[model samples]
Target: MRTLNNHKLKLGILDQSALMPGDTPTDAFRRTIELAKLGERWGYSRFWVSEHHDTPRLAGSSPEVLLGALGAHTSRIRIGSAGVLLPHYSPFKIAENFRVLEALYPGRIDLGIGRAPGGMPIASQALRYGRTKPSDEQLPDVLRDLGGFLADSLEPGHRFEGVRAAPFVETKPDIWLLGSSSFSAERASELGAAFSFAHFINGDGGHEAVKGYFDSYRPGPLGSEPRANVCVIAICADTDEEAERLALPVELALLLLEQGQFQRPFPTYEEALAYPYTEWDRMRIQVNRSRMLVGGPVSIREQMLNFAGDYGVEELIVVTFGADPAARLRSYELLAQTFELA
Candidate 1:
């Protein structure tokens, strides 16, 4: 296994600020931008948003748009998707959007790719209309096509042969592979892309997957050495009780997802506090708590440092979820204090 080094832990924010129900896309975008601006002051290295279409709760369906907006507001913090689901969009289009952003931002953009559709079956179908659904078997080809577009490689006789992105961007946006399973680790390693492990997606068994990704990872085009980041659920507070209370928003969402009941992120912390759940919801909540890291600063730091020691993570992206935008922002502040991001 790899060991942690002295590279001042690269802290980042993974914003899904809309899950606080009734949160509008505009609100989510603004909140994320605010966080990015704050992160710049705190010395954070990056701020990543995700892409989820047709989801009432998630307003980050268009990550590129949000990233562009953030780039305009903040000068230093890195911005990108926790991942853009590659299976649903054309590689050329994805490259084009990112190319434009890179042109505007210079050295401040990243592009993380994931294989999941990131939404319901129907939503995925609608997004990929007329295009073949990508299977794990086809992931390599999809990645290759996207990679080719970025490198501006047009093989002879290919439909996009000799097609160069206009405006001639200066940056090759840093690309990261985001995944909840080991499947993507191999691909990231093979392609020399940085790998981001989603602990929030896989829950308690996340470290095993992270370890697997690093164990099998070999240097590729993104870097000669393997680079990996761990993304996890984190909500910090002055007191453990307060943190737990604030975590209710995410717990409510987990309960809903567990019961196959999906809704938009709530609008307020009080709104989530009123949600009704069954005994089964209680059971699932108990199970999911093991996957979350919520507590006071001391407790938060201890848990995270221990997890980092046990797993060789090169970067840590903290994700704060809740109904009230203020509460969500507080969670990030608390986490920043704990991680010394501030």
Candidate 2:
């Protein structure tokens, strides 16, 4: 395993918004390209696209497709899914597609796997389409199968022995297991894969989950000690006031999600501030704010440095999707500046 030497903080971006309201897939693709370019220019080490289906606010439904598009545009920044819901796809197909991506991009591809359904129950059903009786256990099985496929093992002389992924690609992509819960920590540790905790979704101070991963870690082909990454929700602007205003969309989006408003694209920060919401909604937003950091570069930098120091994270990935594309890009730029890249 690589030793941690208090190296400079690593940065990455998570692009969740595809289009605001009326933007088509083409527009979203272009925006993705622009975001990737900005990420590379701003010193972001990687740019990960999330897998979301049937969500009007989210543009990345197929990470494999989006990754290909991103692969063509960016130069240095690595690209991959923040994760692909493994239970929804065949492990073989995933290995094949990502192998092709790895071959194309060489050293600049990441494979982050998540066990969640990645969509509403109805949408998930539609995605599976013909599959019946899909079990949660399928995720673990797929992860294991993927590891085998990537390791290029087929057992001795078995049928389909040493069958390489299509495109005849030969490269082992960096893999990470992503989750918002402890269930994933132990699983990733057991498999010796890098672990990424989604602090945005799972409340805060995931100390127990991180400890569980480290304590349970057993050296495997992929790693020796646990390689853990922390994912946080961050938004930075020139002023604290502007940052707070920009954060309104995220707060509203969370509130709406908690209240069963999934597919609706949230209003802008100014718009959200003007609209009327219930007291409960306001309270929920406040509670959610505790789990995120929203402010100017100085404040964001201080918070992130403190967070990284306290958590001992090897990598820090930020998910900064806003109601507007400009705000989203601005957030990335501000993060880069905070990291002294500007």
Candidate 3:
């Protein structure tokens, strides 16, 4: 059996600022900041926040804005978006946003962009409601424009060719393509951007998707070779039983979400325990369980490393959830301790 650590594997965190039970958005944001600060002190390599619009279940709608706060709290760890959904905004404008972030947190910024719409159809429509040209260009074109601006490699006579993203710093933010499929894998390789496979979203097919990325990578201005990571859901505790209990809420939450029954102010783990899941819900949880790694630190270590080995990647980005905020914080601490990350 492979120990799955021929070389040291780095770990990062993805915080969605999930709102639970009675917590306000302000409370959620504060917890997120606290997590970044603690994560840095615990030797985490990166701390990224996610974007979710018009969703009471998740308080973070703007990762770029949240990253600014994270930067203020942590001195060493890289802070970025788990990603910014680029489809709703302009490429040049998005470039400008990251440029400003890079200016503030210079060498510590990552521009992780995704092609997803980011929320429900109504919310997505609301976000782009006032756009004069909603379907101006495809995602690949927009990605190219953003990269061109970031690297100053715009082809001659291209639209917005000379329009620079200003306040440029000595080191620009690294661009990363976030997705869970081959489409993202190929595009990321073609553009020379770092790719982060969302194993938590799509557990299957990641091995092939990631293999395609590393096999067909074409180096560009962003990176000299392929750099890829996998993001997974984890809930670790002192005991396997405790970890499983802590993981209950997100399990139910995902099932409800997949079935179009998600509730606002997402249920806490304790509340979720009382939920009366039908047989179908139980079966769905069994399938969704494949996407999560829930156990004690030792068990979680093996599970995480297995996924890491499967994708042939060295870094794993973890997103943990629980009713107890303390357990959520401890989860990272335990993982770092088990891996001896320093």
Top candidate on TM-score is: 3
lDDT of 3 by residue, 85-181 (tens): 8878887888888988898888999889887877778888787787743342366677878888887778899977777888765667888899988
TM-score for each model: 0.90, 0.91, 0.94
lDDT of 2 by residue, 205-313 (tens): 4767887888888866444567888888898999989898888888887777887887776667677877798888778888898668888988888777777666667
Model 2: lDDT to the true structure: 0.79
* Candidate 2 Cα misplacement greater than 4 A, ranges: 1-7, 132-138, 155-162, 221-225
Count of steric clashes across candidates, in order: 10, 0, 0
Please list the residue runs of candidate 3 whose C-alpha ends up more than 4 Å from where it truly belongs after superposition. 1-3, 130-137
Q: How good is model 1 by TM-score? A: 0.90
Q: After superposition, how far is residue 58 of candidate 1 from its true place, in Å?
A: 1.8
Worst 10 residues of 2 by lDDT: 1-10
lDDT of each residue in 280-326, candidate 1, tens digit only:
87888888886688989888877777666666775788887766667
lDDT of each: 0.77, 0.79, 0.84
Model 3 accuracy (lDDT, Cα): 0.84
Residue 210 lDDT (model 2) = 80
* Candidate number of the best lDDT: 3
